[model samples]
Target: MAEKPGSQEAHLSSSDVSAGQLVQDWSVKEERRARRKIDTSVLPLLFLGLLVFQLDRMNLASALTGGFATDIQVTQDTINLGNQLMFLGIVILEIPFNMLLQKLGPRKWMSAQVFAFGLIATLQVFIRDRRGFLASRMFLGLAEAGYIPGAVYTLSTFYTRRELAKRVAILFFGMFGGNALSPILASGILKLDGERGIRGWQWLFLLEGLFTILVSITLLFLLPGSPDTPKPLLSPGLIRFSPAEQDILQKRLELEDNEKRGGAQGQPIPLKLVWKTLCHYRRWPHFVSTFAVFSTWSPLTTYTPSIIVALGFDRIAANALAAVGASVALIVVFGFAYLSDKTNRRGLSVITAHVCYLVTLIVARQVHPHVGKWSRFGLWTAVNSFAVGYHPVHNSWVQLNCRDPRERSISIAMWVMSAILGLMTGTQYFRGNDVPFYSTGLRTMIIMVSIGMVFAIIQVIVYTVHNRRVAEGKHTSSDGEEPMIYTI
Candidate 1:
């Protein structure tokens, strides 16, 4: 008989072994090596791709503070309308885009979307009226709709559940990083007010959009295809894992499938599956929690620069101040993500972040009328950090529990849709009439975040109850053993 795999004999030198032996004998050392290779090969591209995605989308926030509204002949209300239209496009197109992603493959489909949006963003430099602004924003939204959830699904394919949270955080850290960089970049670019007969805001759009196009072009070559299809369009061996590494990854995926759905793999996501996932008792709370959390956060993100300007800072100073919130978010997101992954308590981390956010909201509410300018600034900075920081844990919770890739895709889409809805509603709170104090908006955020905490608690209870039922044999698993417990 051949020596047992991963046994003493498995340590034989690679030169002495066949490919079959290599696959059968993948050891922990090799597993670590393969994981590191995947991380280096995959994540930086994801970070850059996501950074561009966010930069193109959120650049409008910085631009608005930099006289974009004035030059484009639009009011603050028109800018708000454009933002809503963009998000509406995203909500409408998200599901369809993800459905096509499975067929066209992530690289090809995402590359096309990125390239299209880059062109749209570049075209913003030419806008001279509300029509042009709205048209450009609407098209940009439609082009960028599914990129995020598609990227999440792609990451799911390569990483295990245990390893996913930190990776997701790292991926989304790119978004906060883009947020951190956006104002600084916009401030610098906006300095080109009349360098070539272009407005500062126009220069901001043109340069960032051009940079996006360049990255999209690079992605055609840089983004490796899926594990099943490792070749880029014209490059073979561009992202090849060793044969042993591939085998190990495939097996780990299979093991997870078996744990979740009785070894079923490649099940198509039909309408019924989607409906079931939508109604899954344990899943809905996550959506609600995320919706509420994002509702409170989105306006803060979209209008923070504007708020800083409201505090009497010059446009450049306001934009520069915006980076402080993102810097804090970057630090907090990574730290909390590491702890969530290490402890496998994704829900708890989310709850903690929410609590921190709520505290900031309360403090902001108290001080907005009574405190000095700098104190309110500090409070807003803390709110932004916690608001953005919580998202990775929320995503990880959903991803780990779904287990099925098809289900996960739909689930992520659903959550994203909810988040967009939250954003849309949140934007309504900070109307022009409420400008200086925005007391109504602050109170509403406090209420919504409080609701999010409740939803988070409900999810934890549901997961715990399900796990207990499986442990007590009140329900049966297909494998005739305890079911794989849901991630808490």
Candidate 2:
């Protein structure tokens, strides 16, 4: 069963007396050890789910490298439309599935989602036409829609604000790890094209989708449900938390919320609250910045292998090489997260990531038409490496700005939806006309990222102004949940 917030909410809040008091009683060493336990038990399962989610969601590009387009006889334009429809499914169901999370709980609903999409992904191996491919992609998106944000929200409940930034970075490793792993896996699996009377792309989808279905079973039994229900489905034999550790896990977050939000935890946010947060102007900059920034990523993920192959590399080597930048991205993500936690500057970390990415794009677009193939490959690698580094920091920063638990969930949902929309928009940037170089698409991305940077700057300025008001007792947050601090 998916764990819902109920009796545990009051129980947890009653234990916290004031801001920071609940945490003070727990020794720093003791808490750290307990946190390590939670990380091992909870984070890995979450990471694994996302790894498969991203693999299933993004494998079409990898399949293209294995001759997906030739077998299906779909043009690049049709393929791009498939990707867009997939993201559209995700966008359509993002909020509705989130609403479902409240009813079904994270574990049950998320596990069901894993299985739903896994089956759809596995079935994709049979598609021989454009409509079938497009339909499968859309259904895959529907299955994957709310999983990311829902996972992030559940993660928020398990750790304190201080602990969240780094954990968020770690959790995202699953996605970035998949980005790196997908191509490598496809490169290997694709070699078995004729082993069982299957094409290379068919083997790619069949193996990867079956692997994801197996993971769905693991998710159903191992996800720990929630902080209150910290013992996972197979607890006594495999993963179990002490009562003391569970107490620390759930209460630390409760205390953090009580101090910042003046509110309780482990409850569903109302639909009106959802509407209110949607209309809240303070959070819009993050959404806009996310939209602009994430839009830069879609074409990169969908085309990097193709781009490298265009550099005259072997298709197999191209698929394997595509993982390089994504591999590098894992480190970039962790570095930004560590810096944000170390320096206490989420804004600075995110801004620096955005700046670095924009500069990298500027460099890539400047690449001479006659540059060496390997050198161009290197440039694309660097671009993909820096592509998503800002994302986790941006996610943590967004969380820091919200007023209460309910708004926190709603805001995170908004951020994920906006980012997905951005990805969907970016799929079209590198059109069929762009061909191998995609120089025009690079320029378009530069413009979009520049716009994203502007929104990021606007967010910083807004937060800076609002922080002063908060210090002066004029925090203008809505009445439902009061934002005590605005992080800049």
Candidate 3:
């Protein structure tokens, strides 16, 4: 008593009214499961790429400890000027590179740029003059310009807001891990001195850069572009999802569709749009807050080893002490990011970290010379930890406030540009003549942190008001999405 294949009774019993509908339903379920597994598997490769990128970027500072200043015959200010130029190059190129990512995709364009930067960084071994150093750094900066923002945008595509902070922290920890290990790596490489007449620092750059180049190749093979795309690493069993899971995927797809339709209708993102969005007096506070916090932090990363040397540590000891700072930074960054995600409050996390930074700096600056060296070292560690925590919260704040994809991209670019500009200005504060215990630089950091706190408070107030307006349904936009207030 079996029914025919196309019979209504058979179709209803088996839930396959038509071949097309069955195929469509199965395809949708398969895609959802694939996305969930694909997102998880790609995280390790993402972490590795970020680790390599950060290691290559930061090892230069450690390498400098091994006769770099003597070889180049430049003062600290001049060396810092080179660093400033690198930041300037990054600012100039980031946006264009991000736009290129949109066109060429993150996997292809970002990985290629990473490999190019790695090759260029390795070429630093041949440079003997300031001009050569500057050129190499400029090339390195250009190579790195799109990497971070591209990574951030790419992660956003794969993860929801609930999952973003932890993943971002994980990748960020790789950067901090690189910073922590740089000195140890440099110490080992330093032993390879006089290999073909190359110094230890030269070897550091060459080896590290080669490592990055190799990792970039791996990243090209591993990173998935979108949820719907086939992932090479995902298993077939993981390629299905329930109805609720499909709904979550639909949100991202819909957003992308809207952006494409909007762009195709000749509605390019306008300068006026950026301005109008920023015209909200509330937005100014967050912008200023970001600038101030980063301004304080920039000097630390650029000049911490030099500062430790001034504290009477030998070159090796100075590099080791810098590693301690990196370790503290790694711990604090993850801890703060976790708390922020748990509480869903970017502003509070930022304020707490900055306040800790201000206290650490003040104590470090005024500590008695008679104090034990270990005590001073502990204070320095605390300062670095607090400073490192500042950036993640600030970035989260920006991401929260800039809910629109185009605006978020532009905002991140602007924020990075501002931070780089601040670094450029702060670098001059640490002159060669002020080598040990740069009093001027310390004072400027204190002032900047205080100012940053004020702005952070302002952001909290503005965010609250904006949320209140949205709840009242008084701030609807043309697209009817609550005017896209920055909410973490």
lDDT of each: 0.79, 0.82, 0.69
lDDT of 3 at 397: 72
Model 3 segments more than 4 A misplaced: 1-40, 230-282, 472-481, 485-488
lDDT of 2: 0.82
- TM-score for each candidate, following the candidate numbering: 0.91, 0.93, 0.83
The best candidate in terms of lDDT: 2
Cα lDDT tens digits, model 1, 1-488, are 32344554454433344543322345666767777766886677778888987888889888887777877678778877887888888889988888788778767887788889899989888898999888887888789888878888777877778888888898997788988889989878878888868888888888989988988877778776555554555455355677667666655564445433211123356878777677776688998988887887667767899899888899899889998988899989988888898888888999988888888888878877777788778877877777766888899888888755788888888888888778767767787888865788889999999998999999999999989898887867654655657988
What C-alpha RMSD separates each model from the true structure? Answer: 3.9, 5.2, 6.7
Clashing pairs in 3: 33-240, 34-239, 400-487, 401-486
Q: Which ten residues in a row have the lowest lDDT in candidate 2?
A: 1-10
lDDT of 2 by residue, 1-488 (tens): 21232222223333445543553345455557778876887788889999998898788878988888988889999988898998899899887777677566677777888888889999998999989989998898888988888888778777777788999898899999998999999889888888878898888888888989998888777777666666555434156778777776666565566634311234666889889889988779899999998998999889989988888988889989999999999999999999999998888889899999999999988983768988888899999989999999999999877766667777888899999999999999998888898989999999999898899888889988887887888876456555556778
